[model samples]
Target: MKRQHVIGMFDSGVGGLTVMKEILEQIPELRIIYLGDTARVPYGNRSKEELIDFGEEIITFLISQGAEAVVVACNTSSANALPDLKKSFDIPLIGTIEPGARLAVSKTSGGKIGLIATEATVRSKAYSSAISRVLSKGVLPEDQGLRESWQQGEQSIALVKSQACPLFVPLVEAGLSKTPEARGIARTYLSGFDTAGVDALILGCTHYPFLAPVIRDILGEQTALIDPAQAMVDELKSVLDKLDEVQEMKAKSTVKETWKLRFYVSGDPELFQSVGNTLLPGLIQEVRQVIWGD
Candidate 1:
């Protein structure tokens, strides 16, 4: 495999592992190098400048390791630092927002989509802007799912109801996603989308999938829950196809000769291993500790 086929992914912490799982499952033949800035733990409260600096560091580190394509797996980083990173990096750098937005726009039938993410993601309006950009493409029929129209050089977007589920991340990290308290918290946070009658809901935070069952039960069975990871993986696949990087698909075990996964974290490897085992068994057995500079 060429160096261009290897993807380097980074996040504030283990949350990005969700995206990694999707990438591994969907594009099993692709090589991946993952880094988690665990010492920083949460980037949700950081400023945009800090996010950009941190993202630049990770991107540089990844490139030095021979990663040709960089993926920002953290929603917070994707929302805040992606634009600058794209401009600064020579490689084709991708984030999670646009793909998720496009998917949600196409999936919403009632012309109303709800978003649940961290406070930083909500404040950044990355999803809101991406959804608007997609809706701005053109007007479509009811079957096409949007009631939007393009007129006077502007495109009207469907209703977007976004909420900051800041508490969701910490709970997931603490392994309380299936608890009664978690359900109560999810119920309190998600009732607005249920009331808005949103046909599709975006899991804007990478960490939000752990709470999927609670979210689905509260939002009812009809609402389409959109996870950006799969969409991001699809976007990556498209990039590889366009770049002539993808060879052929094969069974995961069969592709082991060419496929590889390496993990690094800025904090305790044991903690990463312990928590990651619950997410993906045997995937976290060996993680190298990556210091800030190294």
Candidate 2:
């Protein structure tokens, strides 16, 4: 792919910015086009059919914007619609679940792993399935792999405990990351991980990073926290490196210069800017609206 082609990313709301931040930091020369479906935010509660429809709509919009690849930044959508999204679009598609699971598996000093996400992600069992599938394939065996120290028995990787914290996203979006209520809810949801003796915890929802401090405080420093966004960024870089090599071999290589960041929202641009600017430090430009089916 040419350097001129943009990377497309989308989420139910501003949470995807967390993933985008990592991508921008690690791959600064890659242009990005992000869409936040704020008009129909909180896709966690939406039906599978609705989520799939939304994913296709966003994918189409991004392709129209000249995107060569797409990242499904929302855990819920990734869990629900990623396969269909990939089938619907020819470009490379990335999701958060596998990366997050891999990180959890790699970091755990104990076989016990915990996953904390929205209801949809929890119900989908995406993280557990991904980890188990990877482990079963021997690509990263649980017994003697990245998390070998964490292995306890023949089972190697044990039950993956998951909790659904539906309220956390709304709290974060409301700018109440440090509020008492947020702390209370986090403590309630995460206390289970502590009891389960998980050596690593996956922050399955992108929005959960906003409550990182509170979560860390409750889970303690010894419990490794895995942020899937960073893992996804690493995965994207690997893909880009391969693409670059292939292009070079074809004698069509183009040097990647400074990349542009563009933002699109399905709701009010002002509200998105307000939240996005706070979530991501740099000044964001090219803010616009994305009307579905346009």
Off by over 4 Å in 1: 1-4, 138-142, 145-159, 245-259
How many Å off is the CA of 281 in candidate 2?
2.5
For candidate 1, write residues 101-167 as lDDT tens digits: 8778766676677888888898998888888776666424243324433333344445468888878
Instruction: State in Å the error of residue 262, model 1.
Output: 0.7
TM-score of 1: 0.88
Position 163, candidate 2: lDDT = 91
lDDT (0 to 1) per candidate = 0.80, 0.81
Candidate 2 — what's its lDDT? 0.81
Q: Which predicted model would earn the best TM-score?
A: 2
Candidate 2 least-lDDT 10 residues = 141-150
